[model samples]
Target: MSTEMISITSYCLKYDIEGSFIDSLEDGGLIEIVWVNNERFIPYSVLPQLERYIRWHYELDINPEGIETIQYLLYKIDLLKQEAADLRSRLKVYEGTK
Candidate 1:
C-alpha cells in the first residue's frame, strides 16, 4: 500500500489504497459536463459521483510518467478550486436566503 494522488477525471476522482480504489467524490470538475449527449442536458446534475470506496490520497514521492503526472496534478488543483467555489457559492446562497 502506498499513499499517492492521481486525478482520475476532471470532476469524478479516485483515491486508492494498495492499487484498489478506496474513495470517489464530486467537486464540480469540468469533465462533469463534457460527457453530455446534448447541449440541453443539465451539466451539474449529470456529473459523475465519486465511488464509495475512495479515501484520502496522501502526498507521496513516487514519480509517474512525466506528462501524465503533470496532467494529474493540474486536474487535482482544478478539483480543489472547484470545491472552493462550490463552498463559497453555497455559503452565499444560504446567507442571501436567510
Candidate 2:
C-alpha cells in the first residue's frame, strides 16, 4: 500500500470508534479500504470524507442509511448550484451582447 495511507485499526483505536463503523462505511460505498498484507488501510485522500461521516454518525447520531441520503442530497444540491452558475454565466454573455 502507499505510505500516504493510515491503518484503519489504528484510526479506530485512537478515536475510540468501533471497527464495524468502518465496515458500515465500506458497505455504504462512502469510502474505500485498501488491503495490504491482510491489514485494512485508507488513503489520505479519503480521510476527510471518513472524518465527515464519522462526525455525522457519532456527533449527529446518523446511521449509514441516513448518511447515504445526506450524501445524495448534497450531491444533488451541488449539481443544482453548478447548473445555476452556468445559467447565470450564459445570461451574462447574452446581456453583454445587448
Q: Per-prediction TM-score, please?
A: 0.32, 0.93
| Residue pairs clashing, model 2 | none
Error of 1 at 93 (Å): 1.5
- Per residue, candidate 2 scores C-alpha lDDT tens digits across 21-88 of 99998998989999999999989899999999999999999998999999999999999999999999
Candidate 2: Cα lDDT at 32: 94
Specify the highest-lDDT model's number: 2
Each model's lDDT = 0.38, 0.93
lDDT by residue (tens digit), candidate 1, 1-98:
43223333432323233322211112223223232343212143332322211212334332223323454688799999999999999999999998
Question: Where is the poorest 10-residue window by lDDT in model 1?
Answer: 19-28
Please give the distance, in angstroms, between residue 9's alpha carbon in candidate 2 and its true position after superposition.
1.1
